[model samples]
Target: MARFQTPLRYPGGKQRLAPFITEILEHNDAVGWGYAEPYAGGAGIAIELLLGGTVDHIYLNDSSRHIYAFWKAILTDTEAFCRRVSRASLTLDSWQKHREVVRHPGDHDILDLGFSTFFLNRCNRSGILTAGVIGGLNQVGRWRIDARFPRNELIKRIETIATKKRRITVTNLDAEAFMRDRVNKLPPSTLTYCDPPYYARAKRLYLNVYTPDDHVRLAKFIQSKLRRAWLVSYDSHAAISELYRKRRQFQYSIQYSAIQAYEGTECFIFSDSLKIPRDSALPYIAQALRQPA
Candidate 1:
C-alpha cells in the first residue's frame, strides 16, 4: 500500500492544515465521491483528496494556462523536470528563459518543461517565475528561487504520484464553466471544494479578476446543481454569505498568517452545506467563528 506525502506547490495552499479539509471529508464519508475543484491553484486539496483515497475520480480546473500545464507535467513527466529545474539558474536571465518556455514551450518536452517551470515558479520568491523584481515586506513582491532548492526530491515525489494517474482529470477553464458542465455530466455523489480567489483589498498578478458578482453566481450555481455535494474553503467578502443565506450552512472565519506578507489573521471564509450528522466537531466550527478577532 502506497501513501502520498508531497505538498501542493503554491503560496496559500492548505497543506499546513490539511486536516481541516480532511475532517470535512471524513465526516461526510466523501471517499470515492467525485472531487471537483473550481479554482485549482496548486491542486493542493485535490491532490490530498486523491491521496486520501477519498475520491475515486477528480475533476480539476484552473483559469491559468501556466498552472494547467504545470499539473499536466507533474502527472506525466518527472525526471526531465528535475533536470530542467536543476539546470535553471535563478538569475534574471534564467527567469526570462523560464517565462519564454512557459509562453511557447513546444510539445516535444511538454511534461518536463511544464513541471520544471511550475517548480521554479513555486521555489521562486512570490511563487511566480515572472521577473526578478523584489518588493514588499517578507519579500512577497519578488520572484526569487536559489539554484540549490530541492529539485530532486520534488521529482521523486511527483513520480510516485504519477503512478496513480488513472483517476484524475485536469482542465483549464473558468470556475463557472466547469461547474455548469459538471451539473449536466456528473452523478449525484460528486462533491465540490471551492477555494475562490481572495476578495481582499490588495493587488497581485493574477490571470483575471473574480468580482463580487462572480462569487454570488458561483455560490448559487453550486447550490442549484449538485445533489450531494459541499463547498469548502475561503469565500470573498459577504458575497458568499448572501448567496447561501437562504440555505442554512455552517460558516466560519479562520485566522491564518500569511508567511509571504507577515500579515496576521487574514480572515478566510469557510461556507459548508454538508448535512452533517449530530457530531462533536460541529460546535467547534461555530465557536471558532464567534470568538472575537
Candidate 2:
C-alpha cells in the first residue's frame, strides 16, 4: 500500500514505526476501534492508520496553539489553506517574514497563521522553525531554495488529507486533559497512540516541552486507564524506563536524519492489555541501522 504523506514535517515522527503499530493493532483487534493521539505532531501514525482502513475515527490533539490552529484551518477550509500555502515562496526573505508572524502571531488571521506555520516548517531546517535555514542543500548551500518544497505536490497532499475531515476530530488541549476527557468515554476497543516529546531532548527540540515531572504525570495517567489499550513512543532514557518500568517495553532503533546517519534507540511502552509480537520489533533494528544517511 502507498503511504500517506504528511502535510508538515515533524521531528521524531512515527512513520518508520507504523509497521509495528499496525501489527500491534491487528493482534489486539483494536483496528476497528476509534484511534486517539494526545501528542499528534504531524499525525503520521494516525494518518497511516486511517489511510490503511485500520481505524474509522481519529481524535488528534496537540499542545501547541500554532499547530492546532493550522490543523483546524486545514480541516475547516482546506481550499483557502492550500491556496495560501501554494502562494508561499521558498526564499530566505519569505522564511524570515513567516518566522516573524509565527513567533508573534498577534492579530493575524488563522489563514495567515496556518500558512506561516506551514511555510516556515517546510522551508526551515529540519522542519523546526527555530532551527533557521534549511540544512543539507549539497553544493547549493543554505541560501539556495531546495526543490524539495514543491508547490503542486504539497497542495495535492493537503487535498488528500482534507478528504478525511469527516473521520477526524482535531483539538487543542493538554495531553493529560485530553486523555482524561476521552479515555473513559471511548469504546472498549479504542486505542491511544502517544508520541510525546522525548524526556532527554524535549526542552531543546519542542516549544511545548515536557519536564521530568510531566513524564511522571503521563505515566500515572496511562496507568490509570485500566480498560483502554495505549502505546507510547519515547527515546530510551533512565528516567523514562523507571517511570514505565512496570509496562511491557519493546525497543527499536530509528534513523531520524536524512542528511546524516543519526540513529537512536526508542522504546514502545504498551499497556498491560496489549501484546506486540517479538518478530515485529526485532528486525527493524537491523534495517534502521543499515539504512543510508
Which regions of candidate 1 fall more than 4 Å away from where they truly are?
1-8, 103-109, 129-144, 249-273, 277-293
lDDT of 1 at 259: 34
Tell me each candidate's RMSD, in Å, in order: 4.8, 4.0
Cα lDDT of model 1 by residue, 1-293, tens digit = 32335424455665544455566667777657787887877776677667777678877788776777777777666566657656755455655566667666564265645654674565554565443323322334333345325556656667766877778787888877877776347887777777777665323534455777776677677677645465645533465555666654444544443334543233333335564433334354546545553
Q: Relative to the unseen true structure, what is the C-alpha lDDT of residue 20 in candidate 2, on a scale of 0 to 100?
A: 69
lDDT of 2 by residue, 161-250 (tens): 789999989888898888888665778778988888888866656777887888898898888753578888899887888898888775
Clashing pairs in 2: none
Estimate the TM-score for candidate 1.
Answer: 0.76
List the lowest-lDDT window of 10 residues for candidate 2: 136-145
- All models: lDDT? 0.60, 0.77
lDDT of 1: 0.60
What TM-score does each of the candidates earn?
0.76, 0.90
Error of 1 at 227 (Å): 4.2
